[model samples]
Target: MIDVEETYIENRVMVQPNHANNLQTAHGGHVLKWMDEVGAMSAMRFAGNSCVTARINQVDFERPIQVGDTSLIKSYVYRAGRTSVRVRLQVYRENLRNGKQQKATESYFVYVAIDDDREPTTVPELGVSSDRGERLRDEALAGEGQ
Candidate 1:
């Protein structure tokens, strides 16, 4: 069993000119790519095996990550099946100078563990050993307007 906290991952990327759209905001595709990478890393940590994205829930871009700003992506595995893991992911727009952050996008991602043969492999059960882990699991469960 792997503690949810142990699977948690956070990454940051500075939005560059090439990452922006005509409006000078970070492109949706770039944000998504970052999310996918972070989510995969979290799932791999939880499963102890290579993982592949199987599904992504609705992603809403609430705010924009402008050029010269940083994007902080946070992800953690919340639940797991025999071979699949569910991750809660959130992206925030960050201002390095002011240390201010505003949530930009949030979503759920499902990943399947794979073996060396590139076949779906069983994953260890997700463990919630601490109060923080339990709280994060609850938060992910209640995200769908529950």
Candidate 2:
């Protein structure tokens, strides 16, 4: 089994002009790409094998991340099936200058583990022994489908 906390992954990207749209805010696609990458990392950590995105739940952009800001992406594997890992992904906009941050986007991604032959493989069960892990898992479960 893999602890939920052990599957956690965080990444930060500096929003640049190239990442921004005409309005000078980070494009939704870029944000989603970052989320997917981080979510995959978390899934791989838990599955101990390569993973492929099988589905992405609703993604709502709560706020726009302006250029020159930092995009903080966090992900964790909250649930694991026999051959799949479910990850919760969230993105935040941070103003490094002032050290302020706000939620920018959130979503859930499901990934299926694959073996070297590119065939679906089994994944270990998710473990939530610590209070922190349980709380995180509960939060993710409650927020699912919302």
Candidate 3:
């Protein structure tokens, strides 16, 4: 019952020279790394505990983001289990000059909270307190093929 909008978080990072590949575009590894980091944040926020990646459901790259473009990554917790949290992430490339933007990638990640002993820990029931939360939950459920 997490508030989808409240769980929604966005982070922007400038594509640095080191983050690019031979083609001068952001490397796939770099993009995945960023997505993992941001997605972990969403899971941690929902679980309120240390979490580890259990799986990456999918990652789709729609466009390349070149160096000097801003990479805006958005993440939110979409579903939860006793010890697992599902997070959805989206990446966008922003053109600073014209203020244009486009989706560069999208991904879904799963994480599980662990206790001090490194065993899976239970998590609180997600509370869908708002319409946005219900909508996100429905979307996530549908994506699960439920």
TM-score of each: 0.98, 0.98, 0.90
Candidate closer to the true structure by TM-score (higher is better), 1 or 2: 2
User: What C-alpha lDDT values do all the predictions have?
Assistant: 0.95, 0.95, 0.86
Candidate 3 or 1, higher lDDT: 1
For model 3, how does the per-residue alpha-carbon lDDT over 1-146 read when each residue is reduced to its tens digit? 45666678899889999999999999999999999999888888888788999999767789999999999998888878899998888899999888899999887889999988999998777777888778877777676542
Range of the 10 consecutive residues with the lowest summed lDDT in candidate 3: 137-146
lDDT of 1 by residue, 1-146 (tens): 79999999999999999999999999999999999999999999999999999999999899999999999999999999999999999999999999999999999999999999999999998889899999999999999442
Ranking by TM-score: 2, 1, 3
Of candidate 2, the 10-residue stretch with the lowest lDDT total is 124-133
Q: In model 1, which regions exceed 4 Å deviation? A: 144-146
Off by over 4 Å in 2: none
Candidate 1 TM-score versus the reference: 0.98
Which RMSD values do the candidates have, in order?
A: 1.0, 0.6, 1.9
Q: Predictions ranked by lDDT, top down?
A: 1, 2, 3
* Candidate 1 residue pairs in clash (backbone atoms < 3 Å): none
Clash number for each model: 0, 0, 4
Error of 2 at 9 (Å): 0.9
Best candidate according to TM-score = 2
Clashes of 2: 0
50-98: candidate 2 lDDT, tens digit per residue: 9999999999899999999999998999999989999999899999999
